[model samples]
Target: MIIDLARFVEKERPYWQELEKALDEIRARLLDLSDLKQSRRVLGLFQRACSDLARVGQANAEPELRNYLETLVARGYSEIHSSQTYVRRFRPLHWFLRTLPRTFRRQMWAFNLSVALTLIGMLVGGILLVADPDGRQVALAPFPHVAHQTPSQRVADEETANNDKQKMLEERKSSFSAQLMANNIGVSIKAMAFGLTWGIGTALLLFYNGVILGAVCLDYMLDGQTVFLLGWLLPHGSFEIPAILIGGQAGFVLARALIGWGTRDGMRTRLRMIVPDLATLIGGVALMLVWAGIIEAFFSQYHAPVLPYWLKITFGSIELVILVAFYWYCGRKTGPEEEAEQ
Candidate 1:
């Protein structure tokens, strides 16, 4: 029996070990049974164990047994701990939010490109607006039309501007915190979606936004309203532009992932690996949008002529610092995990 057991262990170690454990337990139980019955039960148990060991040995002798073992091990691990199962259960949106900053950081090149492009767009737009024949009309379109002017009319106009500003402030007070978050998230999603079109769509989206900004700046410059434009745009553009650039970065990442999907191991395998990265990118965009909305709703409407430039500069600088720090922290946190996975 000892020799047979040794042979079974050599031929089928996994099955032999399991059978040995069961036999040990049966041996312990048999101590309580009558001698005849214990002998009969021991024989039956030995026969069953031998059958199990033979079945496993035959299976292992088949071609591709290594592959089969790997599959079995993976399946067993998945059944026990279910790491892959848990990842599957994970909601994309939730993952997108959680990993957003890391995704944005990974796409820093694209973000920088978007920033440069946005600045160029603003410059070009400003020039176009300045050269436009109806520059004043275009710039002041946000205001209402009125032909005649009186002392009372001027006061009324001033009051209306104050009222608009106040209303904007109230709205900001109510929703400023959430707006930036929502806007950042939306922009990131848009970037990712556009990336599906092979990044051309993303480029166009960036260009269109750039053109709009440039036209607005040009209009202000042409009207000799440089100071006004600077005051208005500086407060919010500081945060907003960076947020948008981050969005562009997300788009670039998505495009890159999509393009690289099938050139190596095939699409399914690549996508499984990249799912986490994709989530990170989406989260980054969401964060940017939230910041953008806050700036737009709260800081953009400040029209005080006497507001200090230093104050604006200081606040903007601080916000930029915070944003940079956030990305840095996220990078440190997720970078190693991603690298290890790679």
Candidate 2:
């Protein structure tokens, strides 16, 4: 079998070079064969290398060429057998901006359920509070500040408190921030943890939150404090409320994992699968709460004189819209990942 050495080398050189480039990229963690097209391409190249190696041996091709192909084939074999998992350095920005949103979108059904439950609770609480004004004691018992004083009176007290109220607010801001963060974080975690109860506990927690929120808002609205309500709550409430809902979303994800909704995987397997998602959600919620906490203590507490209601409302509205867009579009695959699978 007379092999045309020059012709064979020319024909196979491109494939060999291509395989080498792929291997390098994989080593540097620049390319991922998790994409089916890429994976098949690598696999095909590996087979071709094996076939070429056999021909090289039979034809007694130059030892230098044979050694190069051998090394290339070996690299491809290791990669194909067990794709290297290049652990990325933990990046807070990437996690917050990309991973969190991606995970949120993946578990959006659960998030929708959470929002629905909260809305229902809000409606129920609002109706009850409006229908039975005497039930303020029972309905608003959880919030003594709003419950004890009329909305107008509370507004008066907050707006009038302190010599140079700005200085007073700044002075106590740290303590207030810590307290708010602690309280909100506690509530959010409890909501997520309640997923152990097949989501019933989670649903009830969100609902209770909604009820309190609804009652407070309705009381303010009825007392003709809608502007004050929006100005005060909108700033921090925008981030704080959604953070809690995401917490509830995380709970529902856990509940689905526990219940094994559509998947046939075992309970442990299912739970194990969602560990990353749970962590991402909890982390995202914590960050949002931190922002809310700071805003609540420093910014939300201010009234018309200190921070204009329009400015505050606009800021909060911007934050809410950005948050919504982030979840809807961030980290979505629209590139070659959308290419037809191999």
Q: Which pairs of residues collide in model 2?
A: none
- Model 1 C-alpha lDDT per residue in residues 1-342, reported as the tens digit of each score: 223434644665565344344445543443422357654654454555446434545555443544444444443333333343343344556344335555666557777766776677666556555676564345334443321332234334533576565776676664665755665566656866787787777777676567667776655454465555565666667666666666676666667667783367665666676566666655555555666666656665554443554565566667778767766664354456456756
The window of 10 residues in a row where model 2 has the poorest summed lDDT is 333-342
Best by TM-score: 2
Query: 187-270, model 2: which lDDT tens digit per residue?
Result: 999999999999999999999888888889888998999988999998999999999999999999999999998999999999
After superposition on all CA atoms, how large is the RMSD of candidate 2? 9.5
Model 1 residue 56 lDDT score = 49
Q: In model 2, which regions exceed 4 Å deviation?
A: 1-86, 164-168, 333-342
Per model, how many backbone clashes are there?
Answer: 17, 0
